[model samples]
Target: MYEWSETDLMIREAVRGFIDKEIRPNLDALESGEMPPYPIIRTLFAEFGIDTMAADGVEKMLATQRARESGTDSGGAGSGSGSGGGLEGQDSLMAVVISELSGACMGLVSALGVSIGLGATTIMSRGTLAQKERWLPGIVTMEKVAAWAITEPDSGSDAFGGMRTYVRRDGDDYILNGRKTFITNGPHADVLIVYAKLDEGAAAGADGADAVPARRDRKVLTFVLEKGMDGLTQSAPFKKMGLHSSPTGELFFDDVRLGRDRLLGETEEHRGGDGRESAKSSFTAERIGVATMALGIIEECHRLCVDYSRERTLWGQEIGRFQLIQLKLAKMEVARMNVRNMVFNSIERARAGKPLSLAEASAMKLYSSEAATDVAMDAVQLFGGNGYMAEYRVEQLARDAKSLMIYAGSNEIQVTHIAKGLLGR
Candidate 1:
């Protein structure tokens, strides 16, 4: 049984209060493909300092301690050890805050997820002191928004295997060339964490360049690609089945030149070498971020369905009274609890400075994403005709839920990851 501290409770209440006051009323406006007023997001950040809470002075103390032991600083807040203590308590708080904020609106939550988890994580975990000094402050302060560019036109699940994007070293610059598809926040991101092959031959030689590698190989490298860089172009937003407000689009990099500093990790010593170790590390963090986002969306779907069932009625009784409806609700509850527990447990392990096996992360992502899809579909069924119509929120839930299965390493890809992790190469 996971216990919540007073601080955790307070954070949850505060975030939920802000959501109730600021976001819920504006749901209609946001749902119509209109951006949620920036002032609202700004107000929450200003009043609560949401972005920095997980990185602030006290939080930093804890994170540093945890990072020292874990050899990686991946958990957001309270994962660190400090004089203040209560690391586990802090993890619960962070989760509650994320869940509440996400429950209000997934677009906002996803934006934060990418910006904080991926955007800041790249610099925090891999950047040099200078790079951290330059990027971390902005990300921590919410001054810059970050997006990840890994999924290419034909490289959804097979991203690393078929990654055609190439970065060629040219003295002090690396020229990047490629196209990324289905990029979340592509239209508005200020920074991009891109993965590309620095040397295709090295990658292939290391056995990390194929979807079904012959060995336990690693070679792909990642970079912190910034916006407005030369050769970085964004396309008009693509029409999507869901998350219309999230603004998915394409990123084109043609002869994009970046300073050597943009290269994330050890480059000189590992030149012409497989970046398998680095790639595995990065993927581990990314999988956690993806799982958290999926969990948030699924929780929301469950909440909405439960709310609808209780309120809507037929034949003088709540529709929830029906046996079939009750069964659907029951299954949703069980799935929701299962996925939530998995996510929270994973976060705890991460906070405790424990190594999370790739199989565990992949399994969690696969289960939660599929759970979200199933719950959303059931929600649509519960809403009957209303669920199919955009007028009702269930349809939107269903739409956004599908993307969960497709993105962040599709469920199919996750299955492969799990199998690989379990099969010993």
Candidate 2:
């Protein structure tokens, strides 16, 4: 039942205009990895006045928190609303920005999403007021980039349980040692949210060395690391299958000494929960985000294919006359409609403060991602030789769509989560 309001359409048109002038002209440079997304993202924030708005929002949220701490908080003044103290009643606007940018260059959207949605959002939800003040201002304003590091080489699916990256308690500090891979913005992030297992060492184990807990059983702790910290190495961007503009890479922490201040919440046990619980709480939102991205991909491919079908001719008639081509177009339209509806439903739920459960989010991710990938591939087939070439752009969309299937917990993992939700396990 939800639809884009007049204001939402106006913002979408503005975003599309920006994309035409800024993103499409540099698509080659962006897709080739010759250009990083940060500069363009920063420019976007400044052009849209997002920087000033984010700064004001953070100041207000922080003021509200301070007032609450001092027991002088009024019910309304300076109070932050909406999920995670973000702009209230602006979820649709945010979604429009994300989807529009995604349609033009998904890589840019990926970089922006991970930096704010996962990285800054985590700190906002879990970090102390001091931590939020120190990091949120720069991050929300796009002055600094942030990365959320959780995936590891051996622990692709089992992020926490199989995590090898760990920190051992030191004298009022923690010695961190481990490596993380496939980290978005890892190569250039100014701030990082790193998750590690808490290794208390053999001394704390019961019955000496025999009682030491297995590595998988250790407590998970979260920390914030800066760009140039000692013993920390951020690798050059990896050559990826798609999303070259996003700059995925690896991070190695070798005896990286972290003070208690670097630990999120400045405590091992956060008031909300431990690091594992904190990380799990983000899964639903992140998966729901995949639907929005998928919707973008689907819409772009559908638009391009429809235009192509009308123009291209064979047997002295337009290709749109062919049933086979029409089938592809029809299927693409179906996908676009379904994904758009899912995104709209999510926006409405967010506005109502009734978020979807993890299982529901997973279902959206699975269906929308598959639909996008299918639609993109079909677009490629419809274009025939043109689609195979990079110049046609369908190849890029296909590659980008494929990455959606693998990224954000993978379709295989989504199936398991959906089952768990259904069985109530």
Candidate 3:
């Protein structure tokens, strides 16, 4: 029963038009690693006025916060509709953009989400007004690319417990040392959000002096670093199975020095558990938004499958007559329906002042991601030999869809989170 308003429909059309005009023609170059995604993304921002939209949205949020501080709202806590009205619409518009672009290139949306959703969001939420003013404008406008680095060589699933990076206080600055791998946008990110454990300067340190403080009791701290900082080395992009448009790489910080201002929030309060909580909350948003990407993948795969089934004749009859081909088409339709409903439901709930809990977000991610992977594979199967070839698009989609289950915490981890939340409740 969920449906887009007329305004939402127009937005979808605009996004699709841009993707067709600027993206599909260049898919070969993008996929072959001959071109980077940032330039295309910047062009999209300009052509669609996404920069202006983002700026207006930011100002609206600030105005609402000011009113809250001044007690100018006669209606009270939930009185001003600005927060609910503007925010919900933004979320919907975001979903539309993600879904449409995903249909064309998953890598584009993946890169976009990390910079704006993860990078800008972290500073905006945890940083002070000064920090936000200094860093946010460039990122929000796509003028500068950003990367969020939390996953280390040792920390993939158990991000907190498995983290090996550590930051220690050194006179008026902090010394950071660690190696982080599989960082999105790392190779060329103008801004980097790095997470490491705070060192208490205890006797036990690295280099066999003691053991690098194996306490495992330290707090996780987040710091913002620029690309050319001293002792900070960024590796070249890694060859990946898919998402060629997105350049993934490694980061190395060898005694990189940082000041208090670099620490998010410019305070020590971020340690202990506040920083961890903030990252987890960001994960929930990221996970919930996965539904939109999955929905797009499902719709695209189903569309291709349905069309193929009708035109692809076998044994002197259309494959659509074959029950086997028909089954795949049916299942794809079901997945498309289920995912679309979840997406619209989330939008409606947000508009009504209801935000999903962590467990709910995990559930959506789990189901939607699996569905996307399934649908993409089925589309490949429906195409038989053609589906497996790069010319068919579904081949790329299959690889891209697989990443959904792995990133943002694997689907396996999501199950445990959902269970823990249920048991706690």
Candidate 4:
């Protein structure tokens, strides 16, 4: 976990080579939001057999689900030696891919993670047999784009309490109404997992609603949706300061209708700790993944800054000779090392089959994001006037890095999570 294994380094080179050939040539278009990252991503997946790997993972999960249902899963008693390690390696490889991609375009990494990591994962972890079979293949293969919609126009930090989106029961069908903003891949997603509470009035009248179990008080539900569904309106991508390759947009559902089959886990009860817990768990993985993304940005910025320092002249000598320039390079190096270690530590913990605490995930996200944003800005400064120009790339990196602080869970929210964990309340 201290350094990339030889195999890991080889994979990095392969990914880097693909990026150079496919992504680098289109950098301008991507930065300008003129091109979506999917075509490039699909090429990457095809070359690396990522889709094959995803297909296999989905098959195994479904098999596991089937076994559990049949009462024949044997409870891991027959799992082969190194199966655990294989899972760990898979996690490590995903981090490597994210790191490499983020270094090139944080937007591409964000889009991929949202579609595969968050969207596909939500369905896999919380879905039933029929649901997994119906949805996971296209998602895993990149044949379909997916968006996990939880944040609404009204809910920013307070997702659950502020969520105004509601689903009203109508016989066996449900009518959904609400708007979601800041949704990744939203503008063009083929599949979506949207979160909403059963309408408050519906909740008050449903069976067991009056008793109001504390756990079910929120009564949030997750529904699988598809494009072209009646009353589902998705806006074009938003013009944001960063993540142009990752299309962010708004969704409006004016009485979009769905049946019970669309319900994740096919249950209205705590199919998985009320829907909020499901979203929170998803955020932990997303938050931790951000640290890896941050490490990539820090690594790239440090490399750029160091190269610029050694080559650029000032006062008749290389800027690297100056104490101030040295200080910036040194700090960037420190951030790179620290974030790298954070990523490796998370990998090692996962290898041991340990789950990161919510607070730990938040801490990792908070520190690494700030560090990345700081390093990118510092890189811009060290490059002088050249850095202000997008041609220099530092400007783009700086802009992209800042968005990390706001996405996933905002740094402010991260602090609140950390403090709540510390206070024992």
Top candidate, metric TM-score: 2
Candidate 1 C-alpha lDDT tens digits along 1-425: 55556887788778888888888788777766575433455577787765456446434553465475566865554433221111223456656766676556667766766666666665565555456656665665567777777788876666676677777778777778888888877877778888777643434344434633522233456678777877899877677777655667899999988787887754634443444444455566556655666666677778888889899999999998999999998998888788778867876686677847877777877787788789889989999998898777777777777877776677887888899988998
Best-performing candidate as measured by lDDT? 2
After superposition on all C-alphas, the RMSD of every candidate to the true structure, in Å, is 5.7, 2.2, 3.2, 3.7
Q: Model 4: what TM-score?
A: 0.93
- Model 2 whole-model lDDT (C-alpha atoms): 0.88
lDDT of 4 at 256: 93
Q: Candidate 4 lDDT, tens digit per residue, 143-248?
A: 8999999987767998887787889889989999899999999998999999998864634445674534432455899999999999999999999998878999
What is the descending TM-score order?
A: 2, 4, 3, 1
Candidate 4: where is the Cα deviation over 4 Å? 71-73, 77-88, 200-217
lDDT (Cα atoms) of all candidates against the true structure: 0.69, 0.88, 0.84, 0.85
TM-score per model over all chains: 0.83, 0.96, 0.92, 0.93
Over the stretch 262-293, how does candidate 2's per-residue lDDT look in tens digits? 99889987777889887887788788888898
